[model samples]
Target chain A: MGELRLMKGNEALAEAAVRAGSDGYFGYPITPQSEVIEYLMAEKPFERTGMVVLQAESEVAAINMLYGGGGTGKKVMTSSSSPGISLMQEGLSYMAGAEIPCIVANIVRGGPGLGDIQPAQSDYFQSVKGGGHGDYRLPVLAPASVQEMSDFVPISYDLAFKYRTPVLIVSDGLIGQMMEKVELFDQMPRITDKEINEKYPWATNGKPKGKERRILTSLDLDPHKLEKHNFHLQDKYKQIEANEVRYELIDCDDAEYIIVAYGSSSRISQKAIQLARAEGIKVGILRLITLWPFPKKPIDELVIKGIKGFLAVEMSAGQMVEDVKLTVRERTKVEHFGRYGGVIHSPEEVLEALKTKIIGG
Target chain B: MSEIAIQDIIKPENLVYEKTKLMTDKTLSYCPGCGHGTTHRLIMEVIEELGQENETIGVAPVGCSVLAYEFMNVDMQEAAHGRAPAVATAIKRLWPKKVVFTYQGDGDLAAIGTAETIHACNRGEQIVIVFINNGIYGMTGGQMAPTTLPGMKTATSPYGRDIATMGNPLKITELVAQLPGTYYVTRHSVHTAAAARKAKRAIKKAFQNQLDGKPGLSFVEVVSNCNSGWKMEPVQSNIWMEENMFPYYELGDIKVDGKLLSK
Candidate 1:
C-alpha cells in the first residue's frame, strides 16, 4: 500500500520514527543497535520533518533526555542494547513514577554482563517483568519480522500517550541486523507547539498567559500521597491488561502439541511446526506479540480443548516458560528448549527439542 | 514614631524592595541561613525582570533544592540526582525558542553528574546552568562532595578531607570555562549583601546569553555556605567562608564572552 523497500530492521525503525512524526530521538550507540542512530544521522530527519536527533554521551544521559523531552508532551524515543538498557534502569523508574510517555526499543544481545553481540531472548523476564525498580510494568511488544519492526514505532507512541506510560519494543540482534522487505507508513506531521499545549495540559512546555504553571516530578515525601499515586498507576496497568493483549494462534485447532514462542523464536518454531506436521506429529505454534499481558485466555482455551503438551521455545535459558507454566497450571505438560548465550537454534533443533523435552519426557 | 500607620509603610511608592511574584507562596524547604533561598529568589527575579516569566522552563536538581519546582511557580521539571544538565539539554534542543536553565548543587553538578555537566558544556548547548558549590552534600545530611576543600571535615570525612586519599577539589567552573563550547563562565559568592548583588548580575547575564541565542552554554557558579553541615552559627560560617573558602575558591568573573580571564 505505502512505499515498499528492502531495509535492515534497525534502519527501517529509524525511518519509521521520522515518518511517525516523532519530535525528538536521543540515543547512544551500542552493538547490534548502533545502526539506529547511524541511520538517523545519514537520513537527517531534522532537515526533512523538523525532527531532532542527538547522540547522547551515555545511555544514562539518553534516557533522561527522553524524560525531559517527553515531559514537554513531545513524542520522544530511544534505542539501546542489553548492557545499555541496564544502565538506563534508574531513569526508566523515574520516568515511570513521573508518568511520562516515551518509547524505548531494546535490540537484545546476549548478556549477564556484556555476554556477546548475538541474538538472545534472555531479557524476557526483564522486559515483561519490571526491568526498573518499583511496582511498575512496561507494555512490551515483541516483533518477529522487519515489517513489524517498522510498524511498531507508531503503535508504541500511540500506546505510550494513550496510557501516559513508557512502552518497550523488544527485538534482538537477528532482526536488527537482517535485511528484509518492509512497507513504510505514510509520513505524519509533527505536532505544533500550540497543539502540544492543547493536547497535554499537564505538559511542562511553559506557562501560557493566564494559565497555571505545570510541574512534573515523582518525589512525593508523604507516604499516603505516594500510595495513592501507586494505586492510580495500578489501575492504568489493569486497563492495559484488559484491552491490549495481542497474540497469534497458528494451526492451534486439533493440535496435539503447541509450541509457544515470540519474536525470532516464533519464526523458528513456525518452520519446526511444518517438520513435525510432516511426520504426523499434529503440532502447532502460539506466537506472542505482546509479552506483558501474556495472552492467557487463548492458551486456556487450548488447554480446555485437550492439548497434550506445550514446548516453550526461546533463545535463552528459559524465561518465558515460567509464564506459560503459570498459565497452564499443571493442566498440561509445559517444557522449555533453546540454545542460549548467542547460539541460534535451527528448525530441526527445535523439532528435536520438542520431541525430547515434551513428547518423550 | 509610635503612631506611624502600617498602610503608609506598605504603600507602593514607599516600597523600596518587593519579592518577585514569580515565586510561589509555598514555604522554601531550605534552612534559614542557607543560600538556596536567596539564589532561587534571584533567578526568579531575573526571569521576571526580563519579562520572560511565561517563556522559561527550569530543571531542578536532587539536592536540598530538589523541591525547587514547588517554590518556582513557572513550568518546572525535577531531574534525577546529577542529571539536570542532561534533562535541560533535551528541553532546550526540542524547544529552541524557549529559555531553559538548570539549578543544581555541588554534589549534583560536580560529583555524580560530572559526565552530564561536562558533555552538555562540550556540546555548546544553548542553556544556562546555575551551579551552587557548597563543598558538601546538604540534602542527604552533609556527605563529602567533589568540591570539598582539602582538610575540610564532612560526614563522610570525619577526620578532615585527606587530599592524598580523597583527591583534590574540582574547580568545575574553571574546568568548563576552558571548553570551547562555553560562551560565558563565572564564579561568585552570595554570603553577603554586596556579594549577593554581584551574583545576581552574573545570573542575569547567563540568562541573557541564552536569550540572545549565544552559540554556547552559559554557566554561573555561586560558592555558598552550609552552616548546619559545617557545625557553625550563620554569622560565624560566613566569616569562616571569608577567611578560608575565599582564598581557595576565589570569587569574581572567570570568563566573559567566551574568553577566559587571565589570573
Candidate 2:
C-alpha cells in the first residue's frame, strides 16, 4: 500500500496514470469526465514524473496524438464522454489496425446522440463489438468502484502492452463522479527511450543503427495482404479470449437464480441479490470485470450446474443481454431488465423485475 | 592509340553530386514524372544536409505521398487523411528536442484536415508542414481538390469548375500565413532547375528553424503538377501549370519571421 486517499473516481484515475508511469496524456474536456484532465493539470505530472499532458483542440486531435505518441512505444491515454468518444472511433480503428498499445476511458453518458450527461451503460456494444469501421476489437474493462477505477489504469496498460492492442475502460458517470477511499499503488518509473528500444524493438522511435526503419501504419492496399493482416488480428483476439476472462461471483454457490451485470449495475444487483436471499429466495450475481473477453466460461459452468434463470440488469435497455443469451444458448432462461436515457435502476426495481420476469416466470 | 586508364580519367574529384543517403533503398511508388518524387528528394536532401536524419520523425499523410515512409529513411507514422499535422504536433511536443514534420497534399491539408492544420499553426507548434498543392487529388484518381483552380475541369468537375455553385479555389497557404504562430511561410515550385534549387533552400530553412528553437510553425507549399490527374503529357502539364497555376498561386515568400508579407 502506497497511500490511502479519498478522491473522486476520475481524479483517482488521473493520479493512477501518473503513478503508472504513463508517458503522455492528451484529451479534450467533456462533462462527467473533465476531472481527469483537470487533475492531471493541477498535479503537474510533468514536474513529478516528467509526464506530458496536453489539452487538445478536440477529441479528434487528442486521439491522433495518442496514435503518434503510442507509435513511439510510449504509454499514452485519454478520457472522454459519449459524444467525444464517438468522435474518436476513426482514430481508434486506425490504432487497432496498426496494433498501437494505448488506453482510452469512456465515462459513458446516455446516448444515441448526446442523450444526457448522467451515467448510462448504453455504449456496451460500441466498446465491445468494434465501434470503428474495420473488423477490430478493443479489450474493454468495467470498473465497479472508485478503487477499481484507480486500479484498472495500470492493469489496462499492462494488458495493452502485452497484446499490442488498445484497451478501453468502459466506465459510467456514477463511478466517475463518486468519491471513495482508494489505496493507491507505488509509483512506477517512466520507461526510458533506451529501455523502450530494448523492449519494443519495432517501435518508431527514430530507428537505431543497423536496424530497419519502422513505419507505423494501417494502410495495406494489396487485397491479399490486407486479408492476411485481418486474419492475424483475429488470431490475437482469439488468444485473448482463451487466456484473459475475469469476473466475480457474489454468493453464487447453491443459487437457484443469478443476475448478470457490470459497473454500477453490478453494484445494484449485489444489493438485489442480498435482498432476495433474505426472503429465502436463492439468488446471486456475477459481476463481469472484463466485458470484451467476457467471462463466458464461468457462465457456461454455472449453466452446467443447472441454474434456474438469469436477469441481465443494466442502465441501458438490454445491450449486454445479447451476449448473455449467446453464452447461455437456451440452457436456462435469460431475460433483461433496465432503465434508459440516463435513468438508473434501483435495487428494489431490479429485484422486483427478477422475481416477476425471471425467477417467478 | 594507347587506351587511357579508365580509373585515371574518372577521379573522385570529378563527381558532381550523389543521391542523399537519407533516402532508403526502397524504390519510390510514385508515378513516373510525378512531382512527389522531386518533392520527396528535396525534403530528404534537406534533412541530410541538416544532419537530422537520426533525430527526425515524419508524419506521412494520405494521398499519393502516403508511402513516403518507404522512401524516407527515418522513423515515421502514417496518419489518416488530413490528420498529419495533429500527429506531428503530438510527436514534437512529446519529444521537444527532436525534429518533426508532416508531409501532406492539397486534399489532405487544404480540405479534410483544415481544422488540424489551422489549430496547429495557430498554437505555434515547433514543427514543419510540407504542403504539396497540385490542384487535384492524385492518389484516389483525378478528382477536384480544395485548391482546384476556377474553370479547371476534373473528374468531379466535368463541365469545368463553376465558381457560382462549387466555390472558388482555396488559397490555404495564404490563410495559414495570417496566423501569429507561423515563423516562416513560403510558396515555391520545382518545374525548373532554378525553382527546384529555391524549393530545396526553403525546405532546409524550415528544418533549420526547428533546430534554432523558433517558436512557430514553418509551412513550405510547393506548387506541383499532376500530369495524369490533369490528363496531359508530363511536359504539357508542366507548361499548363506554369501558365495557369503559377499565375493564381504566385510563388515567393508569403510571410517571414512571423510577419505576413505585403501583396
Candidate 3:
C-alpha cells in the first residue's frame, strides 16, 4: 500500500492527476465537481509539478483547451457535471475525430436539463454511447469508490494514450463528494516531448529538422478519405471491445440471479445482495468497471452458466439496461429498477426490486 | 528589348526576391484569385523574416483554409469550428516561448466562435489572431457571414440580406478592439501590391509582438475577397471589395499598445 490518506473523491482525483504526471487541467466550475478545480487551485500543481491549471470561461472553452493541449501530445484532463458536460460534447466530437488523447471526468448530477445537484447515473448513455455528432467511441470508466476515483486517473490516461482515444471517468455526486481512505499512487514523471514523439509520430509539437510537419486535424474533406478514417476508428473500437471489458463479480458462482450495477448503485447492490442471500435468495452482483466496452463477455458467460435473470440497478430511468438486454439477447430476462431526478435507491429498495422484478416476475 | 543571358537572370545579385522557405512545395488549395493564398504567403513570409518557423505554432480554423497546415511549413493544430482561440490559449500557456497564432475566417471568428474570440482577447492571451473577413462562408458554399454586408447576396441570402430580421453584419475586429487585454488591433487588406505590403507589415508586427513576449492579444484582420463565393471574376471581386467592403471596413489601426487609437 502507498500513502494512506482520507480525502474526498474529487480531491483524490486531483491528487492522482498530479501523481500521474498530467501536464494540464482546464475546467469550469459545476456543482458536485467544483471541488476538483478547487483542490487543484489550492494545491498549486503548477509550482509543484509544473502542471498548467486553468479555469476556462466555460465548459466549452475547457474542453477545447483540452483539445489544444492533447493535440500537442500533452497529458491533459477536465472535470464537470451533467450540464457542463453537455456543453463539451462539440469539443469531444472533435477530439474523437482527430484521434486525440485526453481524460474527461463527468461527476454526474441529475439532468435532461439543469436538473439538480445530486448524484445520478443518467449520463451513462451520453458518455458510453457517442455524445456528440459522429461515428466514434470513448472508453467510459465507472468508478464505484473514492479509491477507484484516485486510481482511474492514471489508468484512464494509460488507456487514452495506448489507443489515442479519449477516456471518460463516469462518476457521480456521491462518489465525488464522499470522503474515504485512499492509497494514493507514487508520482510518475510527466512525459517529455521526445517520449511523445516516439509513441505518437502524429503529435503536433513543432516540426523538427528533416521531419515532415505534423498537422493535427480531424477534417477530411474527401468523402473517401473520411470513410477510410472512420473504418480505422471502428477497427480500433472493435479491438477495445474485445480486450478491455472489465467488471467485478461477487457471489456469482451458484447464484440463480445477478444484479448489474455500477458506481454508487454498485455500492448499494453489494448490500442488496447480502440482504437477498439472507432471505434464501441466491443473488449475486456484477459491478461494471468499464461501461463503454460493456462487460458483455462475462455476462454472456454467466448466462451460459445458467443464470436465470438479471436486475439492472441504476440512478437514472434505466439507461444502461438497453446494453444489458442487447448482450443477453433473449437468453435470459433482464429487468431494470432505478430512482430518477437526483433520487438514490437504498439497499432495501434494491433487494425488493430484485425479488419483485427478477426473482418473482 | 535587350537580350539578357539566362545565367545573368539566375544570378543572386540580379534576383530581386524569392519565395520564403517557410512555405512548403505543396500547391495551395485556395480557389483562383482567392485572397487566402496571398494572406497565407504573407504570414509565411513574416515567419521567415522573423526566423520563427521552428518556434511557432499555428492554429488553423475550420474553413476553406482548414488545410493551412499543408501549406505552412510549421507546427499546426486544426481547431474545431470557432474554437481556435481556446485552442491557441492552451498552446500558448503550455509553451509560452512558442509564438502561437490562429488563422480564422469571417464565419469562424465572427459568428460561430464569438465567445472564444471575446474571452481570449479579454483575458489577454499572448497570441496572434489573423482574421480573414470575406463577408461569406466559402467552404460551405457562399452562406451569409456575420460580416456580410447589408443587401449582400449569398447562398442563404438569395433575396439580399435583410438587416430588419436577419440582423446587421457584425464588426468583430472593432468588437475585439474594445477588450482591455488587446495590445494591437488592426484591419488591413490584400487586394493590391500596396495593400499586400501593408498587410505583410501588420502580420510581421503581430508575430514580432508574440516573439517579444508582449503580455496582450494581437489581432490582425484582413478584409479579403472571396471571388468564387461572391460570384465574380477574381479581378472584378477585388474591384467590388475596394468599392464596397473597404468603405465600411476601413483599413486602420483600431488599438495600439493596449489603448484604443483615437478616432
lDDT of 1 by residue, B1-263 (tens): 58988887888888799889999999889887988899999999999999999999999999889999999979999999999989999999999999999999999999899999999999999999999988899989998999999999999999999999999999988899999999999888888899999999999999999999989999999989899889888888888888888888889888899898999
Please, what are the lDDT tens digits per residue for candidate 2 over residues B36-59? 888889999998888887888999
Rank by TM-score, highest first: 1, 2, 3
TM-score of each: 0.99, 0.98, 0.97
Expressed as tens digits, the lDDT of each residue in A219-292 for candidate 1 is 99999999999999999999999999999999888799999999999998999999999999999899999999
| Two-chain DockQ for model 3 | 0.78
Q: Compared with the true structure, what per-residue lDDT tens digits does model 2 show for residues A168-230? A: 999999999999999999999999988898999768877687677788999999989999999
DockQ leader? 1
> What residue pairs clash in candidate 3, if any at all?
none
Predicted complex 1: CAPRI docking category: high
* Predictions in order: lDDT: 0.93, 0.93, 0.93
Model 3 chain A: worst 10 consecutive residues (lDDT sum): A203-212
